[model samples]
Target: MERIRLTGAQATMLATLYGKAMDARSPNSVLHDTMALEAVRRIDHDFSKVGIKPGDASTVALRSLHFDGWTREFLAAHPEATVLHLGCGLDTRVFRVDPGPGVRWFDVDYPDVIDLRRKVFPEREGDYTLLATPVTPAGWLAQVPADRPVLVVAEGLTMYLREEAGRELFRAIVERFPSGQLVFDGFSKRGIKLQKVNKAVQVAGATLYWGVDGPAELESIHPALRCVSAVSAFDLDGFDRVRLAYRLLAKAARMIPVMRRMAIMYRLEF
Candidate 1:
């Protein structure tokens, strides 16, 4: 089968799907996320089809669930705030969030992803808009309301970006919105090195370029940005319900911080 030509960021969405599917034994958002994973898994790419191993699949599911929990918590508290899902890929967060009457939602991604999203998801009728532009592009921010509080979600995205690009993107977001929150997952140096050796990651063209050793580093990039919560996959309480092997692995990872590294979410105010 001929392989599909997907950018590194685009491929990361596939990884998200694969991960979600692996953890579908529960009644959480993972069940909904599995839809996208199943869609991509059926595609004719060799790496997506055969190269993905059990471990890689587990990682994706865990990360997706973590993001889903964070998003739910954030949206529940700030019903009036606008949501900017950077690198939105094929996620159905709008449906999951089910924004109330006053809430605004925006899904931003590459043209191809946005175009594909249009076909996969329902049209946004009220305060939602789908913007087809790269996350780093200056023009995309113009479409969003500068005065409203915005919540930006960047999942499985920053790792592909060079450190400077990621920093600049964060700075631009904080400067663009007067008061908002930015939730993203970060890769540690050890996690990046692990990806280099992982066959599935190599075949997918995901090369980790940005790894913040600590969440405090984000504060230095922009003073307004506060490190409200720094969570690792191991720290999440949900892991206790997982299978024995997964729970054990999560426990061991916590013992050796570098084993799984950390993924964090931040709140930025200007």
Candidate 2:
């Protein structure tokens, strides 16, 4: 099969898929995304350029674990809630979670990406909907059900967006829903700098434009939003010299706010 060529931002989704696939193959993996593993095998692109070393793949697996756990909890609490997965690339989350009959799940991304997803992924079951549109402060949200609680997940996305764009997106989401939860990851300025040279990012031609130190600053982006919790990549369970470094950095970041910017898993409520 001919390989699909994607824009840098679009290709970042491939990076996460690679991570999930690699993790699934690991013996004691945090995320067992068999779907992701399959997707990686089906796609005919050179994944090595994503510069995902063993440590980096482990980090990606941990991040996937965090998002998966968070979403499961949310669905358990609000079985009938609407789930809006923004910038959802080729991720097989819907199949993995299987939110059942009551939940309304939406997977959204660029029109081209969604088209590719439809071809590669299995047909949707139940109340699953796919929206192909740019995720911004515009037409897309109007189509979503506003009355029910919303669980929004934006993975491997914000770093490519400008600060104002990120602010506008969250603000729009908060404004549309009566109440809900938003889970995403944010990197610090230093991390953005590192991404420029990252093999995968460079190969994908994606650029990192934004970073934040903590959830408090993001809370300022929208009045209704409040920080619930924030965890560092190092705070997750793992044993490695790099993981130890992250653990130590996470602890130190608590003392020094700037250090907190390294990488964060944030849960916010409105």
**TM-score of every model?**
0.85, 0.89
lDDT by candidate, in order shown: 0.70, 0.81
lDDT of 2 by residue, 1-270 (tens): 437878778887877888778878877677788888887777788877666755566667777677888999999999889999999998888888889688999999999899888877889779999999988755789898888899999877888888898888888888888889999988987888778567777877888988887777889998888999788765765534234665565567667755555778889999
Cα distance off (Å), candidate 1, residue 80 = 1.3
The TM-score measured for candidate 1 stands at: 0.85
Per-residue lDDT of 111 in model 2: 93
CA error at residue 117 for candidate 2, angstroms:
1.1
Stretches of candidate 2 exceeding 4 Å from the true structure: 239-260
Q: Which stretches of candidate 1 lie over 4 Å from their true place?
A: 1-4, 25-34, 37-59, 260-270
**Clash pairs, model 1 backbone:** 19-61
Which candidate ranks first by TM-score, i.e. highest?
2
Q: Which 10 residues in a row give candidate 2 its minimum summed lDDT?
A: 237-246
* C-alpha lDDT of candidate 2 relative to the true structure: 0.81
